[model samples]
Structures are given as structure tokens and as C-alpha cells.
Target: MATKPKSPHQEQPKTAPPADEGRFRDDTDVAVDAIHQRIVGREQTEPEEGFEPPPVWVWAASVVLLFVMGFYLGRYSGSWSTVAHEVESPAAAAAGPVKRTVNGTVVFTGVCQTCHQADGNGVAGQYPPLAGSEWVTRDAATPIRIVLYGLEGPITVKQTAFNNKMTPFHDKLTDDEIAAVVTHIRSSWRNSASAVTAEEVADLRAKYGVRGSWSAAELSAERSAR
Candidate 1:
């Protein structure tokens, strides 16, 4: 078969040119490079961690709290030498010792009651009676001497003989105590005599020094001499 020639005005069917593989590859590489650069640049310009000072209010509050604690401790804490529970006030320590009155009845009850009996009516034949006894009411010095140096050998009290020995109270009792006891005995029961003084007992104690028990004859001799 023979082919007819086309008209000059009629256009030939258009066809795409063959792809350039090298050029496409180069364009893909260029796009990837652009994306990578964008990511790297963003990372490089990003903000970094840094130290920041605390707020002014926080520092102020810490200082205020420390001052409050120090003030509280100073106000409440006692001196270093003082104990917590046994803390004594300065006023109490400055005061002098308390004055106490010595009771004669209490002294007699504790010391003399055991041997002399509470009624002053001593044991018959064993202890001499203080009730209406001539020896006790004779003179202040006689009884004082008997009490201070004690009595030995036989002695007549109320016309009755007492052979028992009497213990000395010079070392055991103070001058005031001895005086008070002697006064108590002299005024008690059926006896009525003058009250003994601490000065009298003290003088006798000083004069006699320390001696053994005195006998009735010796006591009589001394009384006669006096």
C-alpha cells in the first residue's frame, strides 16, 4: 500500500522526550539537602539550659525565718548552767535562810519520853520521880549540874533513895535545847520553879569542861561551897 503525505498546516502528534535520569537524581539530592539544612539550622539556633537566681522573696523569707528561730531560742532558753526542771529564780536565792522556832514539847517527846516517862512520875525504885522532888526544885544549879555531868551513887529524891545512874546530856543536846528541856521539867507536873536560861547552861558547861558522873556527897560539898 502507498502512504499519503500530510498537509503542512496539520500538526504531528506530540510525544514526551526521554527522561534524564542523572538530572532527576541531582534534583532529588538537592531537595534532601535543603530539608537537612533546615533541620540542622533550627537545632543550632534553639535555646539552651542556664542557671537562674532564686526570687528575692524567697531569700527574704529564709532570713526572716532564721531571725524568728534565733529570737525564740534566746528568749526561752535559760542560762547554760541552769537545769530545765530545777531552774531557780534569782530572787529566791538572794533571800536569807528561813527562821525556825524550836519546840520544847517536841524535843521532850523525842528524847526524854523514852526514859523519864511522859507523866514525870518516873519508875518506882528504878528512876526518880520529878513530881515534888526536892532534888529538882532545890536550886537551878543542882539540876543543871545533874543533867550536864550526870549523877552516880545513891541520891535522895522526895525522901526516896534512887541508886540508878543518870546519863549526861552535855554532848547530846545544844545549850538552848538543854535549857528548854530543863525549863519544861521544872514547870511541868506538881513542880513550880523559875525557867532555866541558855546562858546558865552554857556557863556551867564552860566551867566544868568534861567530867565523869558526880556523886551525891560531892554535889552536896559543891553546893555547900557555893
Candidate 2:
């Protein structure tokens, strides 16, 4: 069939759609939905925080600190009674009384050794010697009186005269301490004498009460009277 010829400038009609347009739209929608699903899943299933235990070293350090504090308080807290809140223990009561004995040599070395010297030899014309002194070894009561009251003025010892003051130990020493030192001097340095007792010192102290230093003549009179 012969037909009229078309013009050269005639436009063609649209028929089939553009290639891969539907497929590209579907793929873009699927990619967007997958990303949204991933974000929402992460938000819904998030993990919760929980409590955790302290480190081993921290616990160990705490225990050590408590122990050190306890030990320090126990060691430097004065008496056990104070630590026990002033409560007395039955064990201590059952232990009975404690007796204390003074050492004469210790007392002499501490108190008398400076004046009489370690060897009992006195300074010449100053302090009198205690070694082999008739005033010390002859009579027990004389030394006791001398120690309790003290001696002054001129005194003869070992045939030598000394004009000096002997300080009294009545206030400085106890009866037991005075007795011990006197007994030590009597027995030491080749002199054999009887021991002086605390009872004797106490008796003399009670009899005489308190007095001044004694002179040699007074001591001699006292001995003669005795």
C-alpha cells in the first residue's frame, strides 16, 4: 500500500520506557531500608551496664592498711587496762603482788661513786675514803645515821681528817635503797661487815625523824650513849 511520505522534521512517538529505571529504583529502596533496619536493630538490642568487683590489689591493700592500723593502736596504746577500757583482768589479780629488790652496787655506782670514787678511795683532804674506814666498818648504826641525816664538819676516817659536807640521802633515797647501799659499802673493799636491813633504816628514820648534819663529836657521843 502506497502511503503519503512523512516530513523530514516529524517527531517519533514514545513507546518503551527508559532502560533499567524500575530496577534502579527498587535497588535504591532496598539499600535504604537495609541501612534503616541496621540502625534500629542496634538501638533496640543495646547492651546494659553492670556492676564490677574491685581489683585484687585494691582489696589486698585495704586489708593490709586495716592490719597496720590495728597493730599500731595495740602497740602504742599505753597500758593494757587502757586498751581494755579500764577493765581489770582476773589473771592479773591471781598473779599476786610483785616484790622489787634494789641492787646496791647499781645504786652506789649511780649515786655515791662520783664522790667516793669507784675504788672507795676519797679525794685527799676532801671526801673521806670508805675502804677500811673505822667509822663505816666498826659500827653499823653510825653509817646508817650518817646516811639518813648526813655528816658535816671534821671527820676522821682511816686516820685522815676531812672537813667537808656529806649530803643527806633521807629525801633522795628510799629506806630500802639506803640500806642496800650501806650494806654494799660495808661488804665491799676488803671490809667484812653485817648487812643493813630496811627495817633498821626505817626504825632509825622513825626514831630520829628529820635532823641536820652530824659532827664527829656528836657522832662519837651518840655511839658512846648507844
Candidate 3:
């Protein structure tokens, strides 16, 4: 038997493709394989790189700041000496009593000047002159004892008589002040006299615990005997 050739107007038999077991398709017959493929229209962004170390300029600025701070400290730091010359001390230290080694010129003005007058010249016939007075310039004991205790009755200093009783200062002043006043008066006047030391005053005060006023007879009796 002979087979006849198909006509161009007749359609071929259509069969569905093999189905994807886990997927479904749309209402229109779109293939599941096409829907599962990578999308084509959207813009995809790549991830940025991980964290980086700080830039060079930041490190350089920190180094420059440290150098400036170090320079400033070295310039103004008292030549790096620990003397602390400007430290303020107590009022007693400034006054010269607590320091002990301090000079007596301040004590003379603060304590002795009232009675001895500012000029070392006492009132005529009332207080005796400290200037050129033999009692002060001759013997160390004369003025030291007199000032420590006081002087009573008539006393002749530089031939000027003072009958008024002078008050004692042992209770009023410290050993340092007494010594300073003695040193100041000795050097301050026109009279040439040796300086009295703080140690000397301490020794004398120890010998004479507490005593009453001194009489001219008592002071003059033992001149240069001390």
C-alpha cells in the first residue's frame, strides 16, 4: 500500500513538556523553568568592602598635638627645679618668730620701738637712750637681763636717769623674738656692741626660770661678771 503526504493546512499534534514536581505555573501556560531563572530587568547592587583602618592625616594630627603639649610644659616649669620659691608660708613665718633664724630688725620695730622710740633715743628723764648707752654696749648681761625681766627704780643710761618702772616681756614674747630684739638694738644704735644669738637667749632664759623686775643696783653690781 502507498502512504499519502500531509497537507500544509493541517496542524501537528501538540504534547505538554515534562512537569516540575515542586512548582506551579500561571493562568497562561508559562513554563516553570522560565519563572525560576535569574531576573533580567532589576538593578543589582554589589556589597561594599569590610571596615578599614583610620587614615594617615588623623594619626599625624595626634602626634603634632602631643609635641605641642610637651613643649609648653618644659618651657614654663620653673627650670625643672623643685625649690618652690613662691610658696606662701604662715603669718608667723612671715613675722620671723616661728622661723627662729630670721633677723631681728622687724622685732625691734614691732616690740622695742615703742619704748626706745623709733630713733633709739628715749624720752628725756623718762626712758633711757639705747644709743651710746654704756649699759647696753659694755656688758651682754646688762641689756639681756633687763629686757628679759624688766628694769625697776632709777637707772642711768648714757647719764640720762629713768625712774619709771619698765615692764617684763618673758611671758609676752618668744625666745626668738627676745633674741632678735636684743640683736637689733645692739646693732641699730650708734654704740658698737656684739650681736646676741638665739642660743644665748635660750641658755639665759633657762637659767632664770621666771624673775621679777631688775634694779639698777642689781645690774650694776655684777658688771662683766656674767
Candidate 4:
């Protein structure tokens, strides 16, 4: 059937029904209350989605990578060597035990240097000077005895008199420790003298048997006349 066309002046009858006020109202333009306003910008999206698990190819690649890494680490790790991470170092493997050496400088710095001073010139008037002192270079036995038993009462060092009491290290220090320290003090600070042997110190220590500390004169019992 032939239908007449509508004139442009006649507005088309509402094709879409007037937008429903409830459904089509602009929610963004709505004035939210204070309580809801806090969550206005932070609104939780509905039906939150999750990421997919890795594909089979990704799993396969990871397995291959881990296997290769494991093989590489097993070969190059050097876990079988004597020390950790000691690789193909032939010099390290062929090396023999090193001769144990005690640094006498270390011993002197730790113990005697406190009183004797780093320069071996002991505190004047308070402690006797070991540097170029007549008592230090007199003999091996004199120093060994002095250190083992300790010295007490007026002793002249470098022509200066010191009357302090030195604490005995006989009970505390080992034979090697005493020997190292004695040898160190003898040679240090230009105070040149023969090294005191540990064997000599041990002999004297065995003979002494917990006697009173030595007086400057009593050191002469074993001290070589110098």
C-alpha cells in the first residue's frame, strides 16, 4: 500500500520512548552523601576478572631453562674441591701446609705496648723504657726471667728510675706467647738482642715453680753478668 511521506516540519513521533528517569539518569552527576563520597572514586568494579595461568609452552620452557641451569651449576660449581668455590687452581691443590709463624710485633702491640708504649720506650717514671735500655739487651735469660716472673720495685731504665710493679704472666701466658713477646721487645725499637727461645723459657718456668716476683737485684740469680 502507498503511504504519504511526513513533512519535515512535523517532528517524528517519539521513536524511542522518553529515556526512563530511573535507568538513564546520569549517576555521575548525582550528589553522593559524605559516607559514600569516600568510596565514590574508589568504587570496586563488579565481576573482577583474573589473569590466565601460564600456557603449556611457558611451562615447558621453564622446565628446560631450569634443567640447563642445574646442569651448568653442577659442572662449574666446584663443590667437590677442598675449599668452597676453589676452581681448577692447581697451585692451590698442590700446596703443602705452611709453617706456622707468630708475629711478635702483634704480640708486643697487644700486650707490652700498653705500658712499654708502641715505640718500646715505656712510660717514664711510671714504667721502664725497653728501648735501648740496659736491662732489655743484657742477656736472653734476663728478659725471659723478667717477663716470666715480672719485675717489682725501683728499677733504673735509660738512667730514669721507675718503681712500678709489673704483673706476672707466668700463669696466664703460654710458653710460646712469652717467648714471642720477649723476642719482639728485644729486637724492637733498636733494642738489638738475641732471640729468647721457647725451650729456654719453658726450662726457666719449670724451675721457678710459682715463686715471688723478682726484685731488680734478684734477677741476677739467672741473669748473665753484663
RMSD in order of candidates: 27.3, 23.0, 24.0, 14.7
Superposed on all Cα atoms, model 3 deviates from the true structure by an RMSD in Å of: 24.0
TM-score of 1: 0.57
lDDT of each: 0.77, 0.84, 0.74, 0.76
Model 2 lDDT per residue over 148-194, tens place = 89999988788788999999999999999999999999999997999
lDDT of 3 by residue, 133-203 (tens): 88778867678888889989987776666798988888887777887778777777576688877677778
lDDT of 4: 0.76
Using lDDT as the measure, the top candidate is: 2
- In model 1, which runs have C-alpha deviations exceeding 4 angstroms? 1-99
**TM-score order of candidates, top first:** 2, 3, 1, 4
Superposed by TM-score, candidate 1 places the C-alpha of residue 15 at a distance from the truth, in angstroms, of 99
| Clashes by residue pair, model 1 | none
TM-scores for all candidates? 0.57, 0.60, 0.58, 0.57
Error of 1 at 184 (Å): 0.4
Tens-digit lDDT track of model 1 for 58-173: 99999999999999988877655465557567877788664555566777788777767899888989888876777777788888888888998898877888898888888988
Ranking by lDDT, best first? 2, 1, 4, 3
Q: How accurate is candidate 2 locally (lDDT)?
A: 0.84
**Which residue pairs collide, candidate 2?**
none
The residue-by-residue lDDT of candidate 4 on 1-226, one tens digit each, is 2444343233222223355645653555444432343444333224333444658999999999999999999987777677755345677567855546677888788778889898877776788888898888977888888888888998777778789899888987888888888998888878789898789899999988898789988886566443
Off by over 4 Å in 2: 1-95
Q: What residue pairs are clashing in model 3?
A: none
Determine which window of 10 residues in candidate 1 has minimal summed lDDT: 8-17
Ten-residue region with minimum lDDT total, candidate 4: 8-17
